[model samples]
Target: MKEITPNNTNTTNNSKPMQQRKRKADTLGYDLNLATSSGGETAEKGGDGPQRRLWVKDRSKDWWDKYNSADCPDDEFRKAFQMGKQTFDTICDELSASVAKENTMLRDAVPVKQRVAVCIYRLATGESLRLVSKKFGLGISTCHKLVLEVCSAIKDVLMPKYLQWPNHESMSVISDEFETLSGIPNVVGSMHTTHIPIIAPKVNVAAYFNKRLTDKKQKTCYSVTIQGVVNANGVFTDVCIGWPGSMPDDQVLEKSALSQRADGGLLKGVWIVGGCGYPLTDWVLVPYSQPHLTWTQHAFNEKIDEILKVSKDAFSRLKGRWSCLQKRTEMKLQDLPVVLGACCVLHNICELRDEPVEPDLVNEVVDDDDDEMVVPEVALRSEFASKARDTMAHNLLHHNHAGTSIL
Candidate 1:
């Protein structure tokens, strides 16, 4: 109050707070360099201010070194990649031709082996893209791009070689195997559909929702159904996927390319055994569902049940080997079919190579109860097909009772 000048008054007012801040900084052992560098004006500038230093250790070299080292054991490799070293090498060799590096000056592209390993590891283990990226020492975008690219490459190159429908000679051999196993003659393959859960789609969300039971908890989940045809040895011969979960199995079958092929008489002489969820047709045979069953129907159901186990086993081993299919996949709606098809291709490869399935995986069950049987909009049954079914059933029953003494 006694002759206080403007400059002196302002200095006195700021002195106490500055002293207090200096004392706090000293007591807290704060890095004076951080404050001194820009004088804390950046913090006052708010969200657009300079970012703090973030130290991220690059572990890509670690993964690359371990993968390339001779010390990495075969068991470790199998556990990480879900395939033996020989199988991995075989895949690498096969995919190398297709997924080879592109000549680009902008940073070297990932090597073929590393790219294939990333995709296979993601599919085999169903790990998140972030985790797979970390494990492979790649950026998340890099991992994502590589996975889809490799999946496309695999589907394009290997589908014909590995996941094709059996030829006439192969169909004969497969039919013989089916007859030996279940006494079902002329059975080219067994067909079944399983649901693969997915995230709620942005468009047509209701179409993808289906009731599912998990841990005995009944809940509506979004899923897509995969209808597969497998041989007697649990090897997939045909796969039709990307159908909505809300569609019945029969309806999905009716909309499938296989159905079109059958309709065009491409499958005239061949019969595929299916469950009760399918429509009875000359090319596709389903077991009887009525209560008062005849001996022929009973015998036919028994043999069809045995043959259908191949499809069940195929799906079980498929989801079991690639556990990703058992859970809700994080893939985009459009990209899911390709990934699912890639899994089937890999499953066929494993089966063809005689890779021993895990003992626990042998008994794994795949749930096919998503959709109930609905009478198709268009009548799928014909007298000719019904007569063929009845004739087959009768023949099976007669063959069984041929050596018996019927009084």
Candidate 2:
């Protein structure tokens, strides 16, 4: 049934009504009414809506007045701008001072510090050209050019001073060995090949890494060999890399300049201690005397072996960068060995100074066993070992002339 309610008693009118009231005369109690003057807009309190970012009132000046207070257009950033300007001026002053110290050539160009920084960052981080250019605010081409120039300068200036050849008196002990690489065996100082497996190029693949099985011998990958020499303290004195692994040690040694010195010539009277690999006559290898006897020779040989093992680990951990050397690029193959030798020298310098080796493992000595004297049939297959035995036999052919005269 439809019923009529009293005028003031209607359900819609009976509900509680919110009384409309004006904000009490600026309750925040600021000096000026900034909200109304700035064209107040509807703003959501929490939900997504337009925001009111009010400007604080100041007695001394207005917003625009305070912002552009002085004649300088950007008064807000003036202090920071001034700081940057002062830094720029200081750099200019330093450049001027440096230029004053120089003659004509260095005065009108890029500063020496920048060049040094470019080279140092390149060497230490091995960063690419674009990254270096961005960091130094230099052109990519400029960074590349500076790096090459600095490397060349270092090679020319520093190498001659620090990397001169050691005299006979300077080197007390020398250790030598041959390492196999790319099927070519080169008579090297240490056998720590750290076998870097390179993918065979498309052409002449077999020549680089032979994979075919032959009738009379075993199948082997094509690899190159590097021959190196280290001093008594474990620094590489010399290195000859890039002979094929298939090449015999004797052939590599015979052609090497070091071999010429070994033939009773340049390095006369110098005694070299070598493992069973090097075919040089002036070297002495430890004998398996009396079936794994704990003699002086055995201990010495063990020491040499330990040194090589440690050196290999150290070389493997080297963080140094290497540039691919190509013959077509007019780069010499010898430079690779030179850089390797430099690493070894640096290694030795660190070792001699009692600095910790990065590898952090000390060489361990194994217990001597009589079984070690047992020569495997593989010993006969080694050309170097066979030649050394033959040479020993030939040297033993000398007659006792003094005993004959006494008798």
Please report the candidate that would top TM-score against the real structure.
1
Evaluated at residue 161, the lDDT of candidate 1 is 87
TM-score of each: 0.80, 0.42
Candidate 1, 1-407: lDDT as tens digits: 22222233455664666557656754543323222112222122345454423112233447755865678897787767667778878888888989998755423567888899889889878888777867776666678889999999989998888998878899899989988987767889899888898888999988887754332246667889999999988988899999888887888998898899888887888889888888777788788876787666777777777888788878888988887887788789999889999999999888888876676754654565534444444434767878887887788777773112221
Write one digit per residue (lDDT tens) for candidate 2, span 1-407: 12222222445532323111112222323222133223332222453544533322222213323323344343232221211223323323433432222334312244655564455444334456656665664555666666555445544444444334457445432322221110101222343222212334445555445232121225344444445455434455554555543444455555665666656565553433343443325432323333553333343334445545543444433322211210011123333343334334334434444444223222321111101222222323335643553443333223211112112
Q: Which residue pairs collide, candidate 1?
A: none
Q: Whole-model lDDT, candidate 1?
A: 0.76
lDDT, residue 162, candidate 1: 92
Residue 102 displacement in candidate 1 (angstroms): 4.0
Q: CA shift at 201, candidate 1, in angstroms?
A: 0.4
Lowest lDDT 10-residue stretch of candidate 1: 33-42
* Candidate 1 runs further than 4 Å off: 1-57, 61-64, 103-106, 212-216, 362-380, 401-407
lDDT for each candidate structure: 0.76, 0.38
Q: Which ten residues in a row are the worst by lDDT in model 2?
A: 321-330
